[model samples]
Target: MSLPPQANSTRKALVLFSGGQDSTACLAWALERYAQVETIGFDYGQRHRIELDCRQTVRRELAAQFPAWGAKLGDDHVLDLALLGQISDTALTESRAIEMQANGLPNTFVPGRNLLFLSFAATLAYRRGASVLVGGMCETDYSGYPDCRDNTLKALQVALSLGLDQSMTIETPLMFITKAQTWALTEQLGGAALNELVIEHTHTCYLGERQQRHAWGYGCGSCPACELRAQGYEGFLAQQRAGA
Candidate 1:
């Protein structure tokens, strides 16, 4: 199906989804601006298998709203980056240490995760006949991961254009937007009403432990991941209470 047009006709977008806050927010963001939107996620074999499960759940959530949202995010593509996970012994894979910051870069940095995710998304865009790829990489309020930088996205865009026959665009809707702003965006896109998704469906726990989640998510509440989600939700809740 075709996506709706905002101001510049129809924009095609491919969302790199993790079924988490940022990606889910970006999915909603892309739907408003693009004519067609597709989502791609990775199964890097992180210790948190719950994340994969949540991703599927989030996909189903979006699928249920496909027609209502008026944008098409086709089937969820799960790529086996298990090898990448094996080599990644940092916080993202096997680090025993807890995150130091509440909402900044942590030890869980995967060297080339976003790189691989975007590469695969670009390839899928080519096959699926899309012209844009959207992701939820926030530099303003993230753990300071290098991959979330603007330059990284630009570099990937260049690399993909050079490596592939078809030219595709990568859209980082949440690049500059803070996590708080992301929460606002999700609410603006009508996702906040789906409070269950905001809480249960998305996997934000770096440890990947479902038993660890609170009303917010699988966050340790002290770790950077949990802290950020908490902080952002605080902003979201406050705004919701204030009515814009």
Candidate 2:
């Protein structure tokens, strides 16, 4: 998909970056479209704290590799959402095995996660005078997370605009794209080098195992998150091979 033209070089954006593949791709997407881009991550006491480390690593690497683009990013913010983890007992927060919930949601599903995240991110964007907020939530190839749906994000966008009494466009470049498409997007935004940097630095394992690497990236290779990433990367490789 073609990226929309930037309204102005002064226009800034705040990206909801989790340092996972999708969010990392969104960060790259934001950098390409916005004159100034800032990223925010949540420290909601997740069991996989390695993702947070990945976030910082990715940020530093981007700053080093793409100095011009990285200069556009303001101070990165990592919010404390420890209370959310305290109240929620799920696979992502606790030691429980991942399974489908009784209500049909996955055990990894943290209810209202995106809602709260975007809400907070909107506030941050407003304060920073940013007209755009970007996130990597996707319905396609998702693990049945309701918050990842485009409709939900659109509704939340309207609600946030109304609440803030300001015009804020929530950009979800990865909303409709599959994970394989996300990898392609990384290349589109930067190049093969940036894509390789992401694969080498970003962490997506629910189990947070970094020692063992896979075809996709670092992960336990057995967790649901790793499986999804591996599948998408495999699909991406297949597509590349077929095109070749």
Candidate 3:
């Protein structure tokens, strides 16, 4: 997927960055377009709490590698949604084996996670003077989280605009693109440098394993997140070889 550069660089946008691979790609996507971009994360007592640390590393590396984007990167906010974890009994928040639930969604799906993330993000954007909210949520190449659906987000956008009485836009750069395309997007946004930054700094493993590194990144290599990332990387390399 080729992401076009934004001509209107004056727009201010807030990104829902979780320090994961998709969000890292979206961050690069936003920095390329928006003039001033702020980031927000939620600490919901996730099993992969290492992502919290990865977010900081990714931010530092991005600023160091691409000073141009670093200038546009603004303040980052982390909200404590620990209550979310306390109330939910899921694979992502608790020590349990991941499997399919009776509802057909994966046990790793944290209910209302994205919805709450967006609501809080909209509130922050309201205060920060940003009219657009960016996230990496995607219905494609995902674990079938309901809140990641495009329709769900569009409806939330309408609800948020009306509730805030302010016009708001939610940007999902990875919404329609596959995981392979997302990798391609990172390269398009910042070339091989950004791709390397994502591979080295971003964290997506549900188990939070970083002891071993793969050609794609660090992960346990068997979890769903790791599986998707590895497959996407292989596809990305295949595309590169074909083009070469």
Candidate 4:
């Protein structure tokens, strides 16, 4: 879906950013819509801690390269949730081999991760007097994470609003878009330069390797995350070549 026009400039928004392609795009999306946009990242003790570095790098580059939107970037907050790592044995938090569960969920699936993230983001937004919480959870071209579904986010939005006794809107701009579409979105938001920055700075690989560059992003190229990103990027390039 195309982004709606900017509403009240005084309105504030908090984005659940992971410094990944989707979240970075969501960050730019939020900046376009809200006058005040702040990003929050989770240090959930994931094995791929390099993502945090990528987050910082992207934030800095955005502020430097795109001053108008970048200046809207408020304080960047990183919450320490190391306990999540201790409690979960998933490949994201653990060094174990990534595999699919009987239910077809990859080992990277961390139960309640998004739930907790949005809940926390709501609390933060409430404190900041923000009415909207932005995230990058997408069911399309996703890794089969149940929490990424639109229905799940809608339910969480209700629960958060009821529990907080405050009206809250959870914005999932990427909910129905594939990765290739996500790339298109970045270009639509800020043009080709923004898209290029996302491709170069965002980290989507499950293995968290920065040196090995591909058309998609940096990754070990062996993990499921890498494979998905690569495929989507290839599709995007093919579409571009076909003048679609």
Candidate 5:
């Protein structure tokens, strides 16, 4: 679907952009749904920055590709959560050795980071007059962050509405979708404008390797991000073959 014009615009969305495939696709999805789409990013010292850069590429691409629409990447609304380190000992917050288990949440969990980010995003959305805040948070495909679950999202919705005294929607476009669906959505939105360019540009890896795969256009294809990405790509391929 095409993005509706501002004249008929009643809904606005603030996307939590990390510039990964999912978030970027979610941004595109928001574009199709909301008349105005704004993005907010966080530089919480998450240990990897490729994702942020990936977000930048998407913004730049939007500016270049959708110049008529004037959809530049929204402000780099990142809050430095460096202070969280003082109280956070999570693997993502500390130099602690995080071992990946076969099943269950990993050590990469950053305590209350998503909650805090959403709270900040909610406040920003209220100030911006947005009706919704879109995020790339996923449940079907995720890194085991508890906050990414469906229940957490629903609860956050309630908390934000109550705490802010305003109704703002937290939209997770990829919550039920696998990684492959995300890529396909990007492709569907702008074809080469997203799928090929995004795969090559975004930093979806947790390991944050920039030069590991120049051909693929992303990061270390061995990390958790890579695994999920690989699965998504594989699913995308399967869909292509099935023609469904």
Candidate 6:
């Protein structure tokens, strides 16, 4: 969807940043449009907890490389949602094989993950005076996580607004866009420099493997997240070449 009016700089935004590719792009998108932007992450004891570290690098690089966005960037909050990990037995939170479940969903699917994430993000936003909540929960290129669906987030938006008695807007800029489009969006938001920054800094491996780096970024190259990123990067290059 088109971004909220660029003129609305008076509004503050809170992004649900997981230090992953999509969330990193969402952060850039928020930085480009919002006057003030803050980021929130959940430390739910996932196997790839390295993403938590990568987020800090992404933030620092963004501030150092883009002064304008850096000025707009605000506080970073990391919530200890260890309860989520305790409750979830998925491949992400546990040491298990990444495979499909009999129910048709992947083992990586964490139940109520996005739901809990948005709820907590909204709570934080309410306290931070940020009316706009931005997330990278995309339906276009995802692992069929029900919580990532647009309708799920839309419903939660209404519930959050009603529960808080405030008009809260959940903005998913990447909801309808493909992963390749997400790469293009990063370039559009902050140019080639931002694209490179995201590529080098963001972490998408479910296994938390950073020892090996690829043309797309760092990952095990076998997990679903890594494969999606690799294919998307190739598609992004193809788009650039075709345009050239």
TM-score of 6: 0.97
Clash totals for all candidate models: 8, 0, 0, 0, 3, 0
On residues 1-244, what C-alpha lDDT tens digit does candidate 5 reach at each position? 2432445255878888887777778877777666777889887766675577667767777667766434533555766767776677666555555566455768777778789889999988898888788888888887788889989989999989998988878878778877777777778777866677676667776767777774345666766777778877888888888995
Candidate 2 per-residue C-alpha lDDT over 1-244 given as tens digits, one digit per residue, 9 for 90 to 100: 4655666567899999988888888888788778999999999989898899899889888888998878886789999998889888889999888888889888999888889999999999899889889988888988989998999988998999999999888889888888888888787778898889888999899888999977688888988889989998888888889989
Q: List the residue pairs that clash in candidate 2.
A: none
Q: Give lDDT for model 2.
A: 0.87
After TM-score superposition, the amount by which residue 171's alpha carbon in candidate 4 deviates from its true location, in angstroms, is: 0.3
Considering every candidate listed, which one attains the maximal lDDT?
A: 3
Best by TM-score: 3
lDDT of each: 0.75, 0.87, 0.94, 0.88, 0.74, 0.93
| Candidate achieving higher TM-score, 3 or 6 | 3
**Count of clashes in candidate 6:** 0
Better of 1 and 2 by TM-score: 2
**Candidate 4 lDDT, 1-244, residue by residue in tens:** 4765877578899999999988999999988888999999999988788999999999998888889987799998899988888888799998889988998999899999999889888988899888999999999988889999999999999999999999999999989889888887888888888888988999988877888988777889999888888888887788788985
Candidate 6 residue lDDT tens string, 20-101: 9999998988898999999999999999999999999999999999999999999999999999999999999999999999
Candidate with better lDDT, 5 vs 6: 6
- Candidate 6, poorest ten consecutive residues by summed lDDT: 1-10
Q: Select the stronger candidate by lDDT from 3 and 4.
A: 3
Model 3, 1-244: lDDT tens per residue?
6566787598899999999999999898999998999999999999999999999999999988999999999999999999999999999999999899999999999999999999999999999999999999988899889999999999999999999999999999899889999999999999998899899989999999999999999999999999999999999999999999
Candidate 2, residue 140: CA error in Å?
A: 0.6
- lDDT order, best first, reads 3, 6, 4, 2, 1, 5
Give Cα distance to truth, residue 45, candidate 5, Å.
1.3
